[model samples]
Target chain A: MEIITSSKAMQERALQLKKQGYSIGFAPTMGFLHEGHLKLVTQSLQENDVSVMSIFVNPLQFGPNEDFEAYPRDVERDKKLAENAGVNILFLPERTEIYPNEPSFEINVKNRTGVLCGRSRPGHFNGVATILIKLFNIILPDHVYFGMKDAQQVAVVDSLIKDFNFPIELIPVETEREEDGLARSSRNVYLSDEERSQAPHLYKGLQKGSEAIKKGEVNPSSVIHIIENYIKTNTNGKIDYIEILSFPNLDTLEQIHGKIIIALAVKFSKARLIDNIILEIHS
Target chain B: MEIITSSKAMQERALQLKKQGYSIGFAPTMGFLHEGHLKLVTQSLQENDVSVMSIFVNPLQFGPNEDFEAYPRDVERDKKLAENAGVNILFLPERTEIYPNEPSFEINVKNRTGVLCGRSRPGHFNGVATILIKLFNIILPDHVYFGMKDAQQVAVVDSLIKDFNFPIELIPVETEREEDGLARSSRNVYLSDEERSQAPHLYKGLQKGSEAIKKGEVNPSSVIHIIENYIKTNTNGKIDYIEILSFPNLDTLEQIHGKIIIALAVKFSKARLIDNIILEIHS
Candidate 1:
């Protein structure tokens, strides 16, 4: 495995692979590799001749009050985990290298980004779209893997790829979970022991919502209310948002005829945990 | 020459060309090809194995009051001109093809865009940056060409290329002009015969400013006053802005040091015209 820090080097390596007819798969992450990220890497290795994983703690994605400083990053450990997971290249760019100066250019996905996480953390999706574009251009990956943990991010990236007509294929892997059903995330480390015990409630709430919908709860508002009630009763966590949005586009729908993403964000102490489940309902 | 109207078709063709070891040179334009645009196409033909020119009158780049609808476009004439100029592919995507719905993503370059034309036409550079990025990604060109007539645009694009690390090279072709020194533009068609005659004065004013700076006049305010005075006296033109800014970056300089770009925009009776000249002065 080759470990590269410079953007130029990564591009050169990606180009070389392209020239040699090697299909490149990329997984972009903010270090602190969890099983969730490794799942993405594992999928990339299965589908492409070369897999490149980038660990960038994008400062732009974090709001002024967000956990940019405390966001987990362990380079040596991440590199080991990535290599073991069959990643061919580990791209670790410094903050200055990723963002030389204040970024002049921003990529914003309209409408889709103004809700959910986008509402509380303004400019977050713009930052995600911008850095993802930079990563896509730099690595020139044939396939890019994103975890379903960030459901809105997946939707935004999918829209960007289609809108810009980037040749990259977006493969969204299922959310990796702990044995106790808590979604695996680096931020999960921030939860206190008691908060950790209650953290699984977020995903449990999503599952309950999905089950209710599957058992013929078609009213969007009623579904949201049930999920909100579940969170309120089961845990002390503060609900950021409990939304039943149409899958893929994330548009709010009156009736759930197709796949709907039951997504939510909850805050417990210093940790903010987000999770979702896609419900495909027949008319 | 192949004519592709769909983004998917053009990207496929571009990919095929890449696989066959042909480097692509691209000229992105809003049609009604003029001598300036032809110069860019000619350069593209010379520099790469294949030249792809796209004509998209991007709505995003136009202000609410700007002449987006009235922007000159002659597809038949443009096709003949591009074919004659040795263009390999001419991409003419319809409005629906480029903007299916309102565009969600926007690319903005700060500081560089808020001067000259950008100041007058707010969100113009954002539109330009967005479409250019889309074109660059779709065409996957080896070298992209732009005319020096849009001097601030060149700087913004140059900054974008650097900031985004797009693999394509940016080639700034010299400004192409008519015999009387009026920079060739599609918008020139909007000028009445009398307005056309007065159009050359815009260039003349730039020349006067350049000569004054060459003769050791360094204060921007005095230089701008003289240029504005020339335009006001020579033609029925309303001064939009007269700025003597640092070249490339377009920043306002207290004292002219190495190279300065003297740029101005004027509204004639029937058309808006802009011109500039870079003055390299020795200390």
Candidate 2:
């Protein structure tokens, strides 16, 4: 496996590989290697001639008050996991490498970012979109993988790719879970023992909400109510938000007879966790 | 040459050619092709295995009060000009085809657009940056060409490409002009006979100002004064603005020790014309 530390080097390698007709599948991560990230790499490996992963903890994507400094990173462990998972290239660029100077333009995301984690962390997805533009150009992948664990991000990226008419295919991998239905995340490590146990109920509440909708619940507020009650009764965590919106678009639903997402966030003692379930409804 | 009106078809053709190792050179333009547009195509054709030209009168770049509806377009004429100029593919997507829906994101350009035409026309470069992002993704060109007649646009595109790290090279073609030194433009047709005769002074004024700077006039205000006097005395048109600033970055100069641009705009009876001259300074 080739580990590239320079963006220019990565781009040059990508250019050469592209000219030689290699189909590259890329998964961009912040690099605390987990089953969630490997799942993307696993699928990427299975689908393309080459699998490329990027591990840059982008400072641009974190707000001024957010966990820019505290974000966990372990490049050596990430490299070993990438190698074990059969990734062909690991791109690990520094902050200066990604942004040699302050940018002159802003790719302001005006949609699909008004709810969930996006609402709480303003300017986050704009930063994501900007970094993705840079990464997309550098990597030049035929297919890019994004996990649905950060479902809003997937939706925002989908809008970006569609709105910009990018030729690359976006492959959204499902959220990897801890078997107890708890979504896998680096933030999961911040959870205390009891908080960890309580966290699974986040997913459990979502399941109940979606199941209720699947059983012909048409009102979004009713589904939201079901979720609110389920979580309140089951978990010790403070509910951050519980919302039902149109999938991908994230627009308020006038009716539930369309593809929708039941998403929620819960604040535990030490960690704030988020999860969602997207469903297609005919009624 | 093939005239593709569908962006999807254009992208598919681009994809096929790229996979087969054909390097594409692209020049995007608004229709009513002039010598300025052809010069870009001429270079593009010379540089790559395939030359792709897009004729899109992007409404996004036009302010609500600006000449969007009055913007000149002649696709049939443009198609002939492109074919005659040896362009391989002519992309002629309709406005609806380009925007199918109103964009949910805004690629706001915050720098290098504070002066010249961008200052008077807010959101113009943002729209330009946005459309270019869309076009770059669709065309996937190895090299993209832009005429330096609209020097501010060239600078903004420079920022966009640098900030996003687009792998495609930006080739800035020299401004094509008439024997009288009037910069070639479709809007030249709108100039009255007297206005036509006086319009070349815009370029002449810029040339004289740049010459003064070359001969060691360090103060930007002094340079502006020289150009303002020359244009006011020589032309019957109204002097809109005369500016001397750092080139490409368009920042106000603290010292005249680097590349700088002397630019101006003139409003005649029926049309507005702009011109500039860039100089490299060492002392």
Candidate 3:
């Protein structure tokens, strides 16, 4: 596996591969590879002639108070895991290379970012959208993979590609979870042992929300109440928000109809974990 | 010449041409074609195997108080002008097509946009940056051409392409001038015959500033004063702004040591005119 560091070199490599008539698949990650991230790489490998995985711990995405300074990183371990997971090229750009100076131009995400994780962390989606667009321009992939664990992010990317006319396909893979239904994330490393045990309830709460919709709980408020109550009684974690909104668009619904997502963010002793489930209503 | 109205069709055409190893050169315009705009198209035709011109008339770049509704456009005449200039593809997308709805993501330009025309027209460059990025993604051009008449715009594009890692060359063509030394602009049509003659003074003033720099005037204030006085005396025009700053970065300079620009915008009774001259100061 080739490990490319410089943005210019990586861009040239992607361009060279493109000119050779190879369909490139890309998976952009923030280092600290887990089974969940590997799922995206697996999907990319299956879909394209070449798969490129980028492990850039972008500072732009983290708030001043957030885990930017303490974010986990293990490039040596990640390199081996990526190689085993079939990443043909592993781009690991340094902070200086990605941002020689403060970016003069920025991507301001408007819709689909006001709820869920977006409300908790302002400018987070803007940072994500900005870096992803830079990576898309550099890699010039035919298809880019994203784990649906970050559902709002996937929606933002969809809107970005469509609005800006980026000629790339978005492959949204389903969220990968643990045996206890805890959605795998790098931040899982921050959880204490006791906090880790309670983390599974976040996903379980989403499942209950989904089940509530399936059981003909047509009202969005009542459905949200059920899930909010589930998390409140079952876990010691503090509920940040429990929202039921239209998927992708993320507009508040008068009543649940068509496709909707039940998403939540819970803060345990050490880590904040988020999860969601999409439910489609058939007319 | 092929006229493409649909964004999808234009993207596909660009992709097809790129796959067939044709180098595409792009020129994005807002219709009402003039000699200055055609110069860019001519440069694109000379440089690349295929030349593409897009007449978008982007409303995003126009402020609420700006001349968005009153902005001149002539598609029929522009089509002929583009075809005559050897354009292989002319993309003319309607407002609804370019923007299916309000854009979910916006490109905000920060640097090189706080002076001169940018100060007078805020959010103007953001709109320009956004549409240009969309057009670049759609056209996938090897080279994109812009007129140096809008020197600050060329500077902003330089920073954008560098900051975003856009894999395309920016060809900044010199400003095209009339026999009377007036910079060619579609807005020149709004100028009365007297204003038309006086418009040439803007360029002449910039020329005087450039000559002062050549004559070893290291002081910015003195150089600006020379140009300002020249314009004030030579034409009955209202000075909007007269600034001497670092080239491209547009940063304020204490001492003139490196490459710099003396730029100004002057309003006549009927139209506003702008001009600038870049000078490299040798120690």
Top candidate when judged by DockQ against the true structure:
2
Q: What tens-digit string does per-residue lDDT give for candidate 1 at B20-83? A: 7789999999999988999998888888999999999999899999899888878999999999
For residues A10-84, what per-residue lDDT tens digits would candidate 2 score against the true structure?
Answer: 999998998889899999999888999999999998989989999999888998977778777777888899999
**lDDT for B221 (candidate 2):** 86
Against the hidden reference, what TM-scores do the models get? 0.97, 0.98, 0.98
**In model 1, which regions exceed 4 Å deviation?**
none
Better of 1 and 3 by lDDT: 3
Residue B146, candidate 2: how far off, in angstroms? Answer: 1.0
Predictions' DockQ, in order: 0.66, 0.88, 0.86
The residue pairs found clashing in candidate 2 are: none
Worst 10 residues of 2 chain A by lDDT: A65-74
Error of 3 at A149 (Å): 0.7
What lDDT, from 0 to 1, does candidate 2 have? Answer: 0.89
Candidate 1 CAPRI category: medium
Per-prediction share of native contacts kept: 0.62, 0.93, 0.89
Error of 3 at A113 (Å): 1.5
